[model samples]
Target: MSNVTTYKVTGMSCGHCEGAVSSELSEIEGVSAVQAAADTGLVTVTFTEEPDDEAVRAAVDEAGYELVGRA
Candidate 1:
C-alpha cells in the first residue's frame, strides 16, 4: 500500500533548499514523490512502505538539513 509521510525539516530557506532536500529523499528505494516547503520546514513524502527513520534522517542530513522527526 502507498502511504504519505511528513517530516519536519529545518534550515531550508529557499526553493533551492527545498529541491536539495527533495532530491536526496527521492533516492530512497520506495519513495514515489517528495514535496518540500522551505517556508514551513515540512517535507512530505509518498512511498510504498514505511521508510526507516534513520535512513530518512541520514538523507536529510546529507542534504544539509535537520530532520526534526515526523510531523
Candidate 2:
C-alpha cells in the first residue's frame, strides 16, 4: 500500500518553486508521487515505504528550501 506524508516547507513562492521541491522529492527511492503547493507551502509525498526524515530534509535543502516539519 502507498503511504502519504505532508510536510511544511519554506521558501517556495511560485510554480517553479513547487516543481523544484517535487522534482527533488521524487528522486528518493520508494517515492511514488509528490505534490508541492507554493501558495500553502505544503508538500505531499506518496511512497511505497516510509522515507527517512533526514533524507527528506536533504532533498528539500538541495532544492534550496527548508523542510519546516510535518504539516
Candidate 3:
C-alpha cells in the first residue's frame, strides 16, 4: 500500500515555488507522487515505501524552502 503524508512548508509563494518544491520532493527514492500548494503551504507526498523524514527535509531545503513537519 502507498503511504500518504502531508507536510507544512514555508517560503512558497507562487507556481514557480510550487514547481520547485514538487520537483525536488518527487526525486526522493520512495516518493510516488507530490502535490505542493502554495496557497496553503502544504505538500502532500505519496510514498511506495517507508519515507525518510530527513530526506524529505533535505528536498525542501534544496528547493529553498523549510519543511515544518507534518501538517
- For this target, which candidate reaches the highest TM-score against the unseen true structure? 2
Q: How would you encode candidate 1's per-residue C-alpha lDDT over 1-71 as one tens digit per residue?
A: 78999999999999999999999999999999999999999999999977899999999999999999999
Question: For each candidate, what TM-score against the reference?
Answer: 0.97, 0.98, 0.96
Which prediction has more favorable lDDT, 1 or 2? 2
Candidate No. with top lDDT: 2
TM-score of 2: 0.98
The clash tally of candidate 3 reads 0
lDDT against the true structure, each candidate: 0.96, 0.97, 0.95
Which whole-number lDDT from 0 to 100 does residue 20 have in model 2?
Answer: 94
Among residues 3 or more apart in sequence or in different chains, the pairs in candidate 2 whose N, CA or C atoms overlap within 3 Å are: none
**What is the TM-score ranking, best to worst?**
2, 1, 3
Ranking by lDDT: 2, 1, 3
* Candidate closer to the true structure by lDDT (higher is better), 1 or 3: 1
Worst 10 residues of 3 by lDDT: 47-56
Can you write out model 3's per-residue Cα lDDT over 1-71, one digit (the tens) per residue?
89999999999999999999999999999899999999999999999985789999999999999999999
Candidate 2 per-residue C-alpha lDDT over 1-71 given as tens digits, one digit per residue, 9 for 90 to 100 = 99999999999999999999999999999999999999999999999987999999999999999999999
Report residue 7 deviation for candidate 3 (angstroms).
0.2
